[model samples]
Target: MTDSAEVPTSRPMDAWLDALSQPTGSPGGGAASGVMLGLAAALMGMVAGYTPDVPAVVAGTGRLDAVRAELLEAVETDGIVSARFGAALGLASDDPAREQRVREAAVEAARSVAELGRIGISLVAEARTLAADGNPHLAVDLAVATEALEAGLAGASLNLRANLRLARVHGASAAMRAGLDEEVGRLAAARTQVERIAAELSARLD
Candidate 1:
């Protein structure tokens, strides 16, 4: 089995962690969250097999396979964006308006992270449907998977908010802040939905 913290791809898990553990920034929390999201999708695919509807199960399995692949891609993207943001922060002191460049770069990274968070939420929502309709015998597994996805979404949100805080310190435009607020609001609703699904699944398990 692959390590949960590493990207769910062909690369060895330890190889990914070797890079993540480095003092350098990229492949940090944001990337790890993406990995978790992919893992959740994998779990969702497993539980989908337990559903009574053969066609729906096949469709869910295929959908989750695609979702997992996309999430793995996002893991790489997050690392790339983090590197870019780190580079921006490295602007030489002699460079005129260096602070402005860093702020802009930071906001761009934060936006991407927030967008990934939104994607993670959507993936969870899709999984919730499958889990809700899964076999009662596997209810606990479904519930655990939902919780794992929720935790991953929450982690992504934390990273996004941290970047946004930096952007605020750099005096981000009011409109940009408003856009972030709206994104966060949407994530909040998704969380509530997951909680309800988890509750329903848990009730069935009992």
Candidate 2:
């Protein structure tokens, strides 16, 4: 059995999340989007790993491969941006004006993270649809994929909300908060959808 912690980062998908957790770098929003996308792809991979030679695998090959590649790339990019944003946040001076600047920077970071979370919702939806339609023989794997995607979506949404709060503190206008509220609502909806899908799939499997 492969130990997840021992998995090599050089492999396309694994590196992004690994890099995100590291103390040294970015992997903020862009990287986070990639990570979420990668996670969706990873779930797809799990489905593939179990489904064997089903026709859907061949039909959906291109889409799955593309998602997988994009996820890896996104993870790397998210890492870079996260690092830069962190550095910028740290550089803000202690003066009142500088404090405002810091808040602005933090807001930007929060927005970025939220955007990634939103992307995750979309990717997870796609993966869920594919898994459901793909191979009944591997229904259990499909169920696992759904669960993983939901976990990623939920985690990303939390990150986004935390960032948005920072933006509100930094003096974002009421308009900004309203827009973010809409996004938060969407995240909640997406999470519910994922959870429902997982439950349905699990019930079917049993």
User: Among these predicted structures, which one has the highest TM-score?
Assistant: 1
What residue runs in model 1 are displaced by over 4 Å at the alpha carbon?
Answer: 1-11, 52-55, 91-95, 175-178, 203-206
- The list of candidate 2 runs beyond 4 A from truth reads 1-21, 28-36, 45-61, 175-178
**RMSD in angstroms between candidate 1 and the native structure over all alpha carbons:** 4.2
Over 41-88, each residue of candidate 2 has an lDDT whose tens digit, in order, gives 666766665555666655555666776775565455455556655765
Per-residue alpha-carbon lDDT of candidate 1 for residues 1-206, written as tens digits (9 for 90 to 100): 75667845556787898899997888888888888777778888778876757565667777788888888888899899999888878889788877787788778778877767877786755666676466667777777888878777877778888888888887788776658867777777777787788787778766
Summed over model 2, clashes come to 8
lDDT of each: 0.78, 0.65
Please count the clashing residue pairs in each candidate, in the order shown. Answer: 0, 8
Clashes of 1: 0
Candidate 2 TM-score, true structure as reference: 0.72
